[model samples]
Target: MDPRYFFFILFTLPTLLFGQINENGIKGYFSFDICEAVDTTDVIFSDYGGGVSGNIIRQAGAMNCVMDCSIRGNSFSMNGLDEQIVFFSGFQSVFNTSDFSIGFYFRPDPGVTKMNLFTKAEMCADSASFTIDYNPSSNQIEATLAQNSSIRTKVTGKLDPDRCWQHVTFVRDDRNSILYINGEQADLATASTRINAKNSSVLVLGSNLCIDRFRGLIDEIAIYDRAINANDVDDLFFHPEEIINRDTTIFLGGSVQIALSKNCADSYQWSPNAEINDATVAEPLISPTATATYQVDMISSDCTAKDEIMITVLDPDDLDCTEVFFPKAFTPNSDNLNDFFRINNPYTIDELISFEILDRWGSRVFFTDNPFEGWDGNFDGQVVNPGVLLYRVRFVCKGVEQTQVGSLTLIR
Candidate 1:
């Protein structure tokens, strides 16, 4: 084995051990650090010797480390005999005996006509491998995996070929193998295959058939010795961010409930004080009397986490009318005190249809359609002499008829 291969194998051993085990004890894994044909000048390293590298020419907001490799003319190629480009990592050595998974960001080189990007293993060589390749003539990205020829799976698609990064995964459980692209299961040639390879070699990145190299970008390569389910893969692809931040404003007498992204810590703290602090509590009810700002902070076991929602409690009555109303007499005496007869009901009346004042003679001295336009003891827009007047009011209240009749002394 090449010294670089030995070092790669040594570095990847921990991935097989770190994953949470299922009943069958399988691990998941991935990696994309190989000297393929594609350039790697602008790759961003997450840690020492690990990060993302690929050529992204078009799509804006394309991740620097996580890019589509199958775009532009850039690609991984292997033309020389015995030339091997190891492009991926995170695969367990033994197959058929242990469940395992591999996932990474990939982009197919549009220029290549035939390509494969997955893992495979050959019993003849006692090797396991994964590969991603493209054929320029076919305009396809093919993924293949094998364990000593005993277990093999292949999936293909007419990919975007625009060199845009897409997420992909290949998983092997006790009885099945699957391929996923962009977090969804892609078509496969087979689902069930028995692995017979023992002590499989370290995972290969970038190349499969010793000279068949991938010419694209790869990022966030991860591997697990444990087999992961569809839901797990979905979570990994869609909600990779550790923290969740949200904000909500609710009316008084109303409530709000928040849902955090998955795989988050179960510890929670709600500001303005909550009835409960448990993270999984659904619909934690809180009734705030006054306007309050509530916050929920969640902490994961890894001590890395985020918060969801700054809940702002609003006062329902803040939108209510609080003005005072008082009974008044209209004198029409040019005295400001009783010049107009008006009732104050700031919260009660929206509009008045008609308000009229009639003399003992039964003639109308004042009438108005506006609630604000009260009886100023006027006739035809002219002030009338002060005297006792009978008033009749007909108005609409809450879409209903309301009639009020009374006598008022309009003194001059």
Candidate 2:
């Protein structure tokens, strides 16, 4: 047996934030950490609380996988030759054609070409299998769910191979199937036919029936019985450090609103909850007397990530703190991408007295007192034309009333 040619399969969970992934619709959760030698046979367990576990069939003489541990922990290392993990139980509901989601983290080997990341197909026509493959040559992810080769739904998305671990999720919401790479929608396809994989068939990771095996470290394999929404996908794909960039200062006794990029988590816990108006919410207003680190534990489905911001309370007399950031431009075309004119960092302002927008003719087009509230490019029940608009904002920063005038381009 070539020591480097042996496969390792683990049935234990890694050190998650709270515990194992406890998502409601999760049918199968495989945390490929901690290897156990069981009668010279490697086994894999679907550890979604009380889900059924299965033995994993591996290629001959594959070494016990324990290399390049990413954030998700120990992973199965495939040699791209023949090593694969075969799970043949409790995976039928996971391949629901109507609404389902499947995700996993993988770090591909350098220069890997066409290789299968997941497959659950049998020789039988009624087996109705699904497979996710990565093709580095085209830099795309090709996926297919089929009742047979003749009746299938195919989808592909851009997949740029990175040296670090990357997340990929395929979500089937009704007839639309969206492929998300690292929390963002990479591609979408409408499925013309319904397909579901039968439980009797084996679910194979790292290789397809065509013998195109994967060459990478795969971990945190998960299967959802429902189509996990974009928010859940974001929570799973992004870590806390990747999202929170607020390590800032605040005037003593002044409150600041701290928030995440998206507030879609199931629950939130702000450590040292005192001095915070609402610690359980995604965005919390905090008035701290002393300098301290506030950490928020964001929990969504089976994933948990936490980010902390060190609030350095400073006296207004010792520092010059009277500046408000305004966005130079905004687009209100209703694409849900930057469609509102809002303050960039409203936390710096203690209180926004009024924010007013005026047309070139000095007509009041929009007015609001909330720093978070934005102008929707509407005036007198009609969307205004794209043009440069003047803005006058009155806000209190560090107990000092400040007025700022600026012009922003409104893009249609």
Q: How does each model score on TM-score?
A: 0.38, 0.56
What are the per-residue Cα lDDT tens digits for candidate 2 across 193-264? 555544456677775566478886777777777888877787676442233557777678788777565432
TM-score of 1: 0.38
What is the C-alpha lDDT profile of model 1 across 1-412, one tens digit per residue? 1111112222223433324322133233223333232233232221222221222122222223322221122223222222233433333443435766766655433453344444344433435555555555765556655554556666766633322445666676755667776667876555355554444444445444443555554454555567778866764464322234356555566665555444333456556574334434433565555545555554443333334445566554453232224354556666467767875543355446677779989898777776666666667777667667787777665567677787787666
Q: Which ranges in model 2 have alpha carbons more than 4 Å from their true place? A: 1-22, 36-49, 59-63, 96-98, 123-127, 161-163, 196-200, 240-412
Q: Judging by TM-score against the true structure, name the best candidate.
A: 2
Stretch of 10 with least lDDT, candidate 2 = 1-10
Worst 10 residues of 1 by lDDT: 1-10
lDDT of 1: 0.49
Best by lDDT: 2
